[model samples]
Target chain A: MERPELPLPQLHAFVVLAEELHFGRAATRLGIAQPPLSQQIRRLEGKVGYDLFSREPGRIGLTPAGRELLPAARHALTHLALGLTAAREVGSGRAGRLRIGFAASLALTVLPSLLRTFRERFPAVDLDIQEMTTTPQLAALRERTIDIGLLREPPAHDAELGFETVLMEPFVAVLPASHLLAGQRAVRVEQLADCPFVLLPRAVGPPLYDQITGLCIAAGFTPQVTQHAVEWQTICALVGTGLGVSLAPESIRRIRLKGVAFRRIEPSTVRTRVAVAWRKNDPSPLVPGILAALNQGPPGRP
Target chain B: MERPELPLPQLHAFVVLAEELHFGRAATRLGIAQPPLSQQIRRLEGKVGYDLFSREPGRIGLTPAGRELLPAARHALTHLALGLTAAREVGSGRAGRLRIGFAASLALTVLPSLLRTFRERFPAVDLDIQEMTTTPQLAALRERTIDIGLLREPPAHDAELGFETVLMEPFVAVLPASHLLAGQRAVRVEQLADCPFVLLPRAVGPPLYDQITGLCIAAGFTPQVTQHAVEWQTICALVGTGLGVSLAPESIRRIRLKGVAFRRIEPSTVRTRVAVAWRKNDPSPLVPGILAALNQGPPGRP
Candidate 1:
């Protein structure tokens, strides 16, 4: 299809007029004179071969064609705004590319689905998915090198970014099949009060560590956290050897380990929430797609 | 921050050169002479106040600044392309609106998630989500009025649009809690072979309806379908009355009916797969966000 030639400034004027619905009000909004705004809208209408507004003296409203053009106009404006932002960021070499830093533990669970969905949806978008530790991911997001970070719990520096929970799963206790708890239909939180627990590393984030501690506290006693591992697999392996009982999300059921039995914990106290965190003022069209994919369950898991 | 003067032709040339790597190949790619391409790149470097390329006669490589500028260049080009497309589309009154024609049966499982995600991500994009039969969703997509469609398995016209599976869930049998089948750990497919079936209407699409028939055939008997309903709720209502057995996705667990009991079918034979269908050439950037959200499991379910 041949490209149409329309003055960009005239289109901008039309957008302001559409939003305000009055010539004088639109002129004021654009910080310009009313006569110039009216002239620009008329020129835009002439160039587009259609009347955008119905201006009958005292009454003014968007015509059918005007209403139809609103979304495209808004999209064009947004695209331009994003382009301007990218140019500035790129010129300074600060934040043009979106380096999506995620933890290795999420690769099998939520990360694959999120990446696949994001890639398929935004093929032109430059996404650098780096496997990093929670500390690096948080650090990168803070330094503005990474545009977004997907973490298991809310990041320690929540004040710098907007965080929204994308996935939440109740914790299931993994234990050796020969253990006494295996015979029970459901394991109570209080039953593990005195048992040795395999816990995530304190470096994962204090909030998550605190959450586990709170769960144990609610269970009537502090858990004897015997092992501190950085990844869930280590925790599961520890549980497999009858070393300790560990809590993990239900989605972790995809990982099969011999001698391990996963039982739903009664009065589910340990709920893990995965969230997407990005700088509050960072403007990127890719954020919406990333969030959408996360909301859609992880890809391969049933 | 002050807005920088970005030379459009130079940026365009630089992007083409970056993609092609070789000056001659870049010239060929942009349909111009090599001298012009080099000149444009030099001009672009001057405009941005930086040296973009490291040239050593036979070898061509990007400088750190050039590497940094690549994503922004691509982004700006994409936005420009979209802007031109939008301008053409709006000039013809076919640009901003997205006519989404969906199947009536899909309203229960897939349509809600698709609409919710699309609306949340692209609020400015006008959506005409019309609830129609499978035939109409296909017809609308072919006619170019609808940008996308949501329908059950085996889309009516596969050649017209690309179909991607958005959600898939096993069909469970709904019965009364006091029923003999409910007492068993899992209801076998053979147990429901002789039971009366409540089937979806034929208009929902033949392939999906046949999937149910095929499952029955696999179980060694043809189901005696005693009722036909257009929606899952209606079929579940019939099952609640002990009139017939009905099949529904795991999402149906959310729907509350006083007398209906959901039991997972062992050796599960039937699985419902919902897909999003769109025209192969549609260029809307917002489509990915909508697709991502739909691909994510429904909110709060996973």
Candidate 2:
């Protein structure tokens, strides 16, 4: 609603004049003529219903009201300045929070180094990190609960989302150290088709799970899933127990299980893709710099 | 120094428009026409070097910068309002501090009741009461260290200070309980001319000290001084010891020394004057209200 506003211009002038205590000097400092400066003071006094300054011959001084208004006026201006500075920082990408959701597996991949470089470049931007598999991450991005998503197998064409691949890794077979396939340096996707699979539930990462099952079918078999686990490390540990064989991205090799061996699959064209996903036409300025860091990564990485 | 100012009016318009997200409604709410409101937004966007609002067919929304500026704009306006309200309170007599310097002896007289009344009437006004005798009170008032003074024997005329009589008491003689004058109901000033006087040093309160000495001059004798003390209670104690006789304001009778007796002086025209003193042209709104309270003490007393 419209209401009476503080005479900000007049208060600004008053604070300056109160400091100078001389109308001529105050006018010069304010970049205005003396008459206008005096008029502004009179207007303020009229608005306040009191004489803010005592003008007597060559002597001039603040009235009690003027003294009271001075500090309060200064406080007002200071608060306004603080507000503007904060807004400017936010408007430019120098401040505010950015929440990111990523595939839990990416933490074993590019997530750490990418986040480190993002933080160093934009120390003022708050990063809220969440580990979500592809399915939940896509949902979080669409709902805007999360601003950026780092997940595998981002949808190729979606009306609401855009994606760019930041990492790609070949699928590898995981076998118990006592298994006969553990002696081979590489295995074929067709060879794994006969093994019971320790796979992630289809609901956890639908696209990646389907891609794996689709490859098995393409190799002339429907793979049997003996067990399901959410994390690659959990699947590898299950493999170490000789429960079943599992297929995982190359990055899962870093897990270092004592009783499991990782083997590259022959013809490694079927790759697990980690893409940076964001809502199409997202307004955050913080996203571009972060996306650049994710894409560039530390050089010599696939 | 002159610097770039946030176009406050434009930001104000922007915040309102951002809230409404409709130009016509926002303009009506701001009591401005739609085109001018749109112009203000455009001008603000120009100043901020970014579009504050995105205009699309059948849709309007705050751009990132607009969202950034909205809360900051509100904060700035709120602070300005706070400043104005504070100044308004001070401009009237509703708030601020009043430093009062008073004679320590006044605590036994009108000080407590007078201050209680003042506090009730101006509860928001801070009372900074400092104990000071007349001479120092006068000096403090001139230095503007204290806003008001309650002291005795204020000078008849001072160019820098103004005084109003608040309380008057006839001088009383303090004597040793065994002294011959202790049995008398009343004694004349001339009767004490030969007695050694126990009195406050002249430097402690020049006017009252001189008033006492001047009374002896008017009695046709120059009294010999025996003891000089700073406090009236100390003076009374020395008198109780039969060191010498003393004359003091009647309120000193409240001290109640068992060895001392207080008796009236004849021709009671010789009264100790306790006055309210302040700077002649004080600009504090608190002064006039406080002065009224000091002058109008509880009922009738000499």
Candidate 3:
């Protein structure tokens, strides 16, 4: 037989009454008056075709039927409350997953602080973090393969993208420990104008390459080229072996290479800009929470 | 941080729109005008502090936020529906547990049929069944240790109890297999006047005891007691051992005792009434379902 459909409001009223066991108290708990509570109970009984409570001179108690119905009523109320909580959490982006791609260099910059604060505040969000170079990260962002991206300032041609610059750090020079000027705290670009340069390959994309080459041209002479490496760490390792010198973001100082030494440029004017990029049209709920965490990280270095 | 309480109605609207991906179709499904649905979505976006849908020249799609909120919205709605079902089942006496007490002899009479039907009709009810004597069963019913009881007719003193007769079977004479009367198809109370009788102890309760003694007195002779057994099975076994003959309800003929034979009593006017009883004031929901099953069992013999 098909089960009867109970009115939610009445069942909710009955549940509170069953717990309080007194009309006045139950009504107070329900934020209503005793007479209305009594009417509701009566209506419930009328609908159920039986009495749920037995009334006596000064006592009130559930009939056997009421006792049987109590647990089910409680269960229904509990589930409804839980459902409400879950809906709110998901709607506000406090629960669910976020797929974010970051330039490998970010692991040493704002990524750590950003991730820690985000996790502490929104632990229910499953962060799917991948480390990729800026090029691939930009591609993933536009293709919608990743929800968010942290990359070097993206190229201007992509008008369909939006980005926020979150970090800026000055570039430093990496040299073999035994180089003639390796012990100097600051190196003038003109002093090494004829030295062979170990640079990131042009095929690795142009942002960092342009920054390094622009500084050299401003110093009045371009460095002679020697070899190319795909990564900053590889560039540092090659420089340590006396292959050539290269420029890197200052955050790479944390790598602590045994044979390599870092020096600030005498007139340090070149800095790397790290920006968060996403498809301008993508409207994910989690983006706000993630952006909030990123914005709240420590202020960018001077 | 405080969590936002998203309005359920708005989330529901967003979920349906997300699924349909078309404003007009979703509005039709929700039985409202498309403008109102759009307004609801706007209100929801305002509350969430983010747009849920990304609309373009004639097409719409979930923004990342909308996609994330969809599953949770669906979950909340589903749980709410389930909660309603559970509440209705309990209020209508279809879910929950029923603690039932029955006389041991009921296992051979109406008990099986009553249980089968009750289970079939209300499968969600957890049946906690126990066997107890009429005296204790009455006490249990009064104390609310059990919700319902099956027993021989209770005394008239129990005005606070309600009962329905579910089984009525005439008494029969139980004889030793070799007794002279055993070969006869019928036995008269007068024929057993000079023979020893085995009977249930009066200390157990008055229902069966009064019926047995009342029948003997009406027949013009009191039974000469030879033994007292607490249970019908023990009395039947004693008769099988030829210790003494006894009278039993007709249903006992199904026991198939090896050394005892049953004979119908002449002018068989004495019958045992088996009833299902509960406290008159019991407001439990389970009692009605149980009573319905009990009443629907095969009708009692005249």
Best by lDDT: 2
For candidate 2, the TM-score is: 0.87
In order, the Cα lDDT scores of the candidates are 0.70, 0.81, 0.78
Q: Candidate 3 on A203-253: residue-level lDDT in tens?
A: 565887888888888999887779997877788888999998887788788
Give candidate 3's whole-model lDDT: 0.78
lDDT score, candidate 2, position A143: 77
Q: What is the lDDT of residue A247 in candidate 1?
A: 69
> Per-residue CA lDDT of candidate 2, range A1-302, in tens?
23336556787788889889899999999999999998999998888777788776686788767776677677656655665566567667788778999877777658888888888888898899998998898888877789899888878889878898887788888899998888888988788767888999999888899888877887888989989998888998999999989777777777888999999887779898888898766666777878877766683142
Instruction: Arrange candidates, best DockQ first.
Output: 2, 3, 1
Q: Against the hidden true structure, what lDDT does model 2 obtain? A: 0.81
Pairs that collide in candidate 1 are A295-B296, A296-B296, A296-B297, A297-B296, A297-B297
TM per prediction: 0.36, 0.87, 0.77
- The stretch of ten residues in a row with the least summed lDDT in candidate 3 chain B is B1-10
Q: Which ten residues in a row have the lowest lDDT in candidate 1 chain B?
A: B1-10
Encode model 1's per-residue lDDT on A9-105: one tens digit a residue: 6667777788778888888877889999889988877865667786756757665466656666555455545554544444444433567887666
Alpha-carbon error at B131 in model 3, in Å?
3.0
Best by DockQ: 2
User: lDDT by residue for model 3 over B192-233, one digit each (tens)?
Assistant: 877799998886768788888788888888998889988788
Candidate 3 residue-wise lDDT at A143? 75
